[model samples]
Target: MTLRNIKSVQKTLGLLLTVFSSTMLTPIVIALIYQESTSLVFLASFLITGLFGLVLWLPAKKADTEIRLHEGFIIVASFWVVLALFGALPFFLLPELGLSVTNAVFESTSGLTTTGATILTGLDELPRSLLFYRQ
Candidate 1:
């Protein structure tokens, strides 16, 4: 891909990331409703994800190039990869879960893909925010 293509992908992925970060607020609401301490976890995840997205977006915001078919493919593939990584933030940040990096990414990817596979053992014991997040 050329630099323009890369910038286009970056711009798309950044906007997607910024939008996706808002989903974390659902869990924050869940946390507040259930009085769970996990609100901070989701809040932190939201800020980090949104900030990273904004950083990616600012540089290419003015790039008004049209996305070709090849660039579309690149964007789709890269979006999933970036989404999975950023989506893992909350799972990785939650200290009570004690999930490793691999497991956290796995869980995030599984959830995003709707695979329903989990390494976690205790569902009932987990906070509502976390449960809502996984769902």
Candidate 2:
């Protein structure tokens, strides 16, 4: 959509993403609580998501006040895709687990979409850091 069309929703989403970034620290906080190496990973996720969302928001926000249903679906779908990719960063890069990138994205998508499919079998004894993220 043109920048002239969706300014209000854009600003709202921008603010929301910024707030969401703060929650990213939760993983690191939990990791620190359990003495895991999640602090850096969480910090990275926080900054990346925050900056990406922040930049997507432009001053053109005041132009658009309401969302059409079709537009709503597109926005939600695209946002989930973005979140899935970035949210998986910790899983894919952590030296402790070092899971493949594809696998990480799959897990993230499944959890986010609530699809019930999982490669995270045998989670009974998963590390506290990983389990914390799950919860």
Candidate 3:
């Protein structure tokens, strides 16, 4: 891919990331409603994800080039990868979970992809925000 294509992908990914970051708020609200301490965790996750997205977007916000077919594939793949990584933030941030990076990413990817798989054993004891996020 050319530099322009790369910039285009970056630009698209940035905007998508920014939008995706807002999703963290749902869990925050859930935490508050359930009176769970996980709200802070979600807040931190939101800031990190949003800031990363903004950093990615600000530089290439002006890219006006069209995305080719191959570029579309790249964008799709990158989108899922980015989502998985960012989606893992809250899971990884919760200290009580004691989840490794691999397990957290796996859970995030599985949740996002609706794979219905889990490494966690105790569902009833988990915070409601986390349970809501998993769904």
Clashes of each: 0, 4, 0
Quote the lDDT for 113 in model 1. Answer: 94
* Per-residue alpha-carbon lDDT of candidate 1 for residues 37-105, written as tens digits (9 for 90 to 100): 999999999999999999999999888669999989988999899999989999999999889989999
Candidate 3 — which residues are off by over 4 angstroms? none
Stretches of candidate 1 above 4 Å error?
none
Q: Tell me the lDDT of model 1 at 70.
A: 93
The CA lDDT of each predicted structure is: 0.93, 0.71, 0.93
Q: What TM-score, to 2 decimals, does candidate 1 have?
A: 0.97
What global local distance difference test value does model 3 have? 0.93
Worst ten in a row by lDDT for model 2: 3-12
User: Which residue pairs in model 1 clash with each other?
Assistant: none
lDDT of 2 by residue, 1-135 (tens): 765445655665665566667767777778788887677877887898788677766564445657777557655766676678877876776666667999999887777677878787678766676676655
Candidate 1 residue 85 C-alpha distance from true site, Å: 0.7
**Candidate 2 TM-score to native:** 0.77
Order the numbered candidates by lDDT, best leading: 3, 1, 2
